[model samples]
Target chain A: MIEIIDLTKQYGKFTALDCLNLTIDKGTVFGFVGQNGAGKSTTFSILATLLSPSSGTAYINGFNIRSEPKAVRSQIGYMPDFFGVYDQLKTVEYLDFYGASYGISQSERNKLIPQLLELVNLTDKQDSYVDILSRGMKQRLCLARSLIHDPEVLILDEPASGLDPRARVEMREILKELKNMGKTILISSHILPELAEMCDTIGIIDQGRLVAQGSVSEIQQRLKGEKLIVVKLQHGLDEAVRFFEDQPMVSGLVKREDGHSLQFIYSGDAEDQVQLLKMALLQNLAIVSFSEIETNLEDVFMEITKGVELT
Target chain B: MRNLLLNPVLNKEFKLRFRSFKSFLGLGLYLLALSVLMVGFIFLESQGSPMGRFRPEQSRTMFILMSFIQMGLILFITPGLTAGVISGEREKQTLNILLTTNQSSASIIFGKLISSVSFLLLMIFASMPIYSIVFLYGGISPGQVLVVLGYYIFTILVFGSIGIFFSTLVRKTIIAMITTYGVTLFLTAGTAFLFAVSMSVSQMGNSSNNPFALFFVMLNPVMILFSFLEPDAFSELSNQLGLGSEFPLWAANMVTYVLIMVLLIFISVKKLRPNMKVKSRR
Candidate 1:
């Protein structure tokens, strides 16, 4: 659905985006994950045609952004991170305004506005002035504006940011519905776990470069070689960890937190892990709970960037 | 189809111009001022000598001058009002949303220009009664009033277009406003200043020396209105200047005004290119 080649954007001495190359397939939700100042917004702005890339080319569904911008614009819905809501305009009028910009007929826009409001779960607020809306409501209204023309692709930058948990959940549901509608979605967000849950594929960027790109399981498996497991116990966790350190498969045992919880770096087969658990049980160690630790996105992200700022 | 693109801009303009108490007060105050000027004229006329406020037979001139003052107010307010139209959108972060739409840049620029001028027109038209009362004085012609009002509208549109063009070019409203004010000042006032300086430079070229010396005076909108009222003054000045009238005069004035407007609008459209893409980049 989209292709970018050697996309480099520079603002004088500062290289905001560096020779970035990416290809996104149609009908997929792609999560763009990076720390703050990782050039995520820069990349999105280039795609949205809000900012010109200092170098490189971008294509939207085969339409070159620089050449056939009108066609590309007509097919895409873009929600900026920081956008304004016209205070006096009704939610429907706001949608109508954008639809008119797209050359949608008045009757056509009227028909679409109600459906879009419903899709964004803002049907009741359609008659309300946009200014009266909460931040989350306004964000949803922005999303509705983007979709007014029934765009084929959605590029949402930080759509869930500043949203309350419930609002975020609502936005997630709406995004899932969009994904199901077969629209290609590209979302840039700092919330990694949410992206991990929401995206079909993910790209990790650091210092204006893509450090990794894959599904959650693929990224997790790639980092499992240096897997970390932190075990919290009910009490006397130190004695259990000391005994766990002596086990054959347990290569490293460090007190993970305040000497009560221990992190084990184990290199062992499934049977070796069972044996270690048996050894811990054999000792008079109080095991509050024990289970295999799953690697969360935070650890993988930290490992990937090595704590370097992208900008 | 283009009308659809312009409607939002028009609607926005109308809403803001009429809804705000300030706009209402401004328009009402303008009406009050024009009426006061009329009342002053009649009160003095009743006392005889026709008040001698201006030329007696040139009551048409007074009417035209009244409209000219109204036009001046519009010209001033337009730059201050619309200098921030586009740049303010960018500041508020709403411009990006507007740019990404399928609407062409031409539509955006045209819509904004019309919207700004619409507000100016509302204030100008609100003083229609004061203008009509000028006919009560018996020296003013209705067709002349219409023509002068036409020129006033044209001038306001030209000035408003300049304001909007600067709005798009500058990143901040203050800068846009300052640039617009400077340009307006230079084009209208500076032209007269240039004429005066040139006329003063030569021993014979005093206001009497050169017919072409008054050429720059055409740039001043009020001078043109004045000329229409007192054409003999132009000839008398030309006689002193010792030169024949080679200039197309009003034809030249019309062409210049139209050309200025065209240039301002063209530059505005160019500045508002529909370049912002909506699709997310890879």
Candidate 2:
């Protein structure tokens, strides 16, 4: 569990985190969505007790990050965005070193390391040098190192940033496993779709402020008046396209590659959608299926931060 | 104390340092350099002597020469050993993770310092047989040898702390090493140079006791080492500085070095966590 209250961090005139407030419940997977330099790392660093906030404070599992940093440190595992591994150490040795650093006894470390390695799907490579492993494998090793103390919360900042698609999927699967194990996870990334499939709730941060926070569909619902409708047609694609094009609500009509389906962005509510559907039926445009498509978080993010500069 | 003894950083550093071929290569090169110098000095001494062989009384000079050479090696090697401990971690981006762990700043700093100093100690201990060569001639007393060895340990501690202080202060390892060497040079050579210049300058005037000159002499590690190795060698400097017989220069040197080392360690620990504000909750 994590609760941040009015946490602000400033560097002279530049604000890295500006009076931001957020909370994540126990065993909840909260994804922090933001572009690069959008204060995601700053917020996470504060929660991890690595950076001191300018004004307010945060709490992890009832321990204040500023006051009880050691308790907060013991309760959470932090995997930084740009961490470097001890290349000279073996995978097991690396994990062991961190375990020892966390004050775990040697016997406990010996028992916990193999299980952590297996959890991250790095059992076979435990004996290999850390530098010799692939990027994905090293990421998994770092994940295991973070889990060495078995902390209740995990603050993973961009865990899958540089991974290839397959490795990203691997990381996702491991996170799913962690989710099932009932660990509260706070992960951050600039890519929306990456966290869309895995996160239970996502918060969009921009320019040191949190703009949106909710489930994927909840956020999409909050930004109403713009809905995407897909119409599957038996025929008459040109006529249906023209009909929707004539309507004031419809814009950005996209024809599907499959000859049967075409989608269009409609800027109207449910009542208007129903009226539009009635008009399409009256036109007898040979409609097979007509339904509103759920907008993904990526589109929701774009719509929310519309005029904001990226990078 | 127990925690410091079994520090995980110490364990990891030892494992990494010894496993690499570089450690062995460094040790081998170090011994080879000392051996070549010792052999050359002995050969030249034998050629200059009337009997065409080294004499017993000459072994004391040889021991003194070897001790100075060993101190020079320590002065050269300690900076390279300690000046990268923290800055290298920063460069590799591992400092944050280490800081987030349960280890306190004191643990991390002391762990790094002890580990690096232990390596330097290992090299010094490994060269013990080289010193044993002087023992065969029976000129140097075992007590004198112990005193010199103790002084060498003190020298390593002072210089190693200097390296770590700079390493923690600077963000880049290369710059940290350069600053460490710069400070070390100022301590070893600059102090002696200033002492000589001040002594010469004072001779033109009252030529009495100058506390500045006395302070320079006490701060100079080379002078302290010589005082330990050959106490009479300090007589001229001691007489000119009006130093009392009650407090020995070597004792004053110990207090000064200990004070400096403690100050450096204190600053290093404080600087290690510049942003960690620990406020106790009511």
* Candidate topping TM-score: 2
| Candidate 2 residue-wise lDDT at A294 | 79
Residue B135, model 1: Cα distance from true site in angstroms: 1.0
lDDT of 1 by residue, B1-282 (tens): 647445666566566556678877877887887888877866655555645444435565567567667766766787887798899888988898998888777777777777777767877777776778766666777777777778778778878888888999889989999999998887667877876776776545333455445577666666676666567786665565564677635557778878987887788776675344332243
Question: Model 2: runs farther than 4 Å from truth?
Answer: A227-295, A307-311, B278-282
Q: Estimate, for each residue in B39-102, the C-alpha lDDT of model 2 and write its tens digit.
A: 8878988899988977767887888888887888888889998999999999999998998899
Local accuracy of candidate 2 as per-residue lDDT tens digits, A159-245: 998999999999999999999989999999999888988899998888888888888777777766678789999999989999998
Task: Going through the candidates in order, state the TM-score of chain A alone for each one.
Answer: 0.80, 0.79
What residue pairs clash in candidate 2, if any at all?
none
**CAPRI-style grade of the A/B interface in model 2:** acceptable
Residue lDDT tens for model 1, A193-231 = 988877999888887888788888887777676546566
Q: TM-score (chain A) of candidate 1?
A: 0.80
Q: For candidate 2, what is the TM-score? A: 0.88
Question: What TM-score would every model get versus the actual structure?
Answer: 0.84, 0.88
Native-to-model Cα distance after best TM-score fit, residue A291 in candidate 1, in Å: 16
Backbone clash total, candidate 1: 7
